[model samples]
Target: MSSSEVECGPSFPELIRRKRDGGQLSKQEIGAFMRGITSGSIQEGQIGAMLMAIWQKGMVAEETVALTQEMMHSGEVLQWPKAWDGLVVDKHSTGGVGDKISLSLAPALAACGVKVPMISGRGLAHTGGTLDKLESIPGFTVTQPVEKIRQILEDVGCCIVGQTETLVPADRVMYALRDATSTVDSLPLITGSILSKKGAEGLNALVLDVKFGKAALYKDLDSARGLAQSMVTVGNGMGIRTGAVLSRMDAPIGRMVGNTLEVCEALECLKGQGPDDLEELVKSLGGYLLWMSGRTASLEQGQEALAKVLHNGAALQKFEAMLQAQGVSADIARSLCSSQCDYFLHLKPAEHKTELTAQSDGTVVDIDGMVLAQVLHALGAGRTKAGEPINHSVGAELLVILGQKVKKGEPWLRIHYDSPAPNAKQHSDLQAALLVGKADSYLASPRVAEFILPPKM
Candidate 1:
């Protein structure tokens, strides 16, 4: 069937055929499609086939917008209290190694007097997920119902939870099919999947961390920018303030990479004492969000506001409160945020640990995050497919900074693992991730490459 012949209540095969032949689906057809997904009127195999068709033929901007709106309304659309008017905001990242910014950013934004109902996901490919990192904390839960999410946000100003069965039900089915069908990279599909969940949140503003590099979804700045612009457009068109940051992801965002270790690093950042790169990312993403939400006079002022809370113990207090609100014991949350808490004693640690030393001495210039992530993923730190179990303790700690000079045989990386330590080949790959160069040749750069802002609305 051609585009014009595909009616609102068209047959499933014809709907698929129209999209497969590059015909743009009408809004009513998209809405009908979403209804089928949520009501189980559509089979999984048919959904997978349709996803492949959409991946190959692609959807126009209007079709993407319609799809997102339908998916968002497929289930419950959260209705926050009217007092939250322009205060609801959230940020999302397109997965990256050692990317734990969400762990601290949410609470920090909350400290600035905004509502953050953060609905996050699990690890995808080589990058870690926000919910997975939060799960590493003892007693921390990510499956809050909408009412409970609202309660948590009301009390603590923030809550990071995953999708409940009734929230964004359309994306839940379609998202699973995308991975199985190898259509995970489709631009319109990704936009709909991401925005549908955020749209369900009833957010006032959103910021996207579109990363590009060896370990990111997009391998170059231009491609990342394109994705950033697409999301920005759709988000703004939906009446939400939206923007994006194009960040480089060649190296890990923070010094640690693993489930529990990332939680520890995030706590350190919450306490105002972690890697500078992590701090920069939080400020950039959070600042723009604050500005777009109308909480600050300007972006710079917003950044300063976020940094002030981050450094003045305000954000830490909010994080502690949020933890307790989300099922963590008050004592454990307090100790974890205390100045002298030993993380391994409070949180779980790996069964075995080993350190890799530098083979030659020079200024550290680069660390290939992809190589490190792959090795850790093999060590059971991450999953190869959805539903696979991962070892929370499997992770790595970078001992040296990118621009720091090192001596030969210096311990540069500490690997935390279980059962079997890294085999000979894994050890070599981890060591090869480091690159040393002349001291003067190494130049530190910003993790944020550029910002993609929506047109004035």
Candidate 2:
């Protein structure tokens, strides 16, 4: 069928056929599909078939833009007229293993005088989610209403909340269906889902950290670049200035991965004492957002401004203040530890410690991010369903990083787990996943791979 013939609320077979045959969908057809899926008028199987077809046939730039706009309009938009003096800026990472840049960057930017209303997601598959990690703190709720979210951003200049059901409800339904149907990786669908929520934020500018490696959703450079380009195209079409950084993911961003552990690492970064690779990424992303917001003329100047906040302890102070305002206390702060996750409930804190003694260690060559995340998942460190609670206290600690020297029979990395959950399978998975090599081995890994810029057109 031609675009004009495809009516709103069309038959499942007709809609499926149009997309499956590489025909364009009218805006009304796309809008109706979103509303139908979200309003329960559409069955899961039909939605799955249509999504599969869209994934196979692909969406053009115009279709992608229309899809994003419809999704954005299905929900409420947030803004702060009086509080934010300059352009309100936000950052998103295409989920990555051990990526906790938001925990630092949000407060760091806010401290630098920009409003950051960050709506984050939870872990799905192998990558960590920002909302899941932030919730590790006691009483640190992510379910605040839109009014409170506005107040929080006004009072503290930043607030991280769970993506409200009312905001981009369409994307929520589509994503759930995509997840079940194995169509979650479609570039246009991914782009629409991401930009819709981000666009609904009423943001002046946005930055994305498009990651590529074994652990990220986009597992290679080509896929990551394609995803980045689609997002930029859609964001620009909607009048939101957008850019992306194609960062390395050969190894995890920081030393930790589980909720609380990663939070502590982010805290360290805000205090100007974080891993080198993680720090570089923070400065790079923070700098880009600053430039987009017109706070800095160049990346170097933005980096220096970010450094002042980190080194002067302003960022850490803002973070603590925000946490306190959000209801987390200092006494219970240690629960942020990767081993203390069991404190929340029937979940037990990780008590078992297994030292991975080096068999013939010269240097640590690689740490597989996906394998590491799977080990945590198997060990009950994270939840499979959105409703499942995480054991935030249980996680791994690396004693030897990549390019670090190690002695034979010495500890390379320590595996910490809450012993209550059965972990026989996870232990084997973790063992096979972490690989170490001889110091004499020649290939040296750079901290960053390449930079992905915004689309010029």
Against the true structure, what is each candidate's TM-score? 0.96, 0.89
Candidate with the greatest lDDT versus the true structure: 1
| Residue 103 local lDDT, model 2 | 93
Predicted candidate 2 versus true structure: per-residue lDDT over 126-152, tens digit per residue? 777788777776678888888888888
lDDT of 2: 0.78
Model 1 score (lDDT)? 0.90
Regions more than 4 Å wrong, model 2? 1-15, 38-45, 82-86, 330-349, 420-428, 440-442, 455-457
lDDT values, one for every candidate: 0.90, 0.78
RMSD versus native structure for model 2 = 4.1
TM-score of 2: 0.89
Best by TM-score: 1
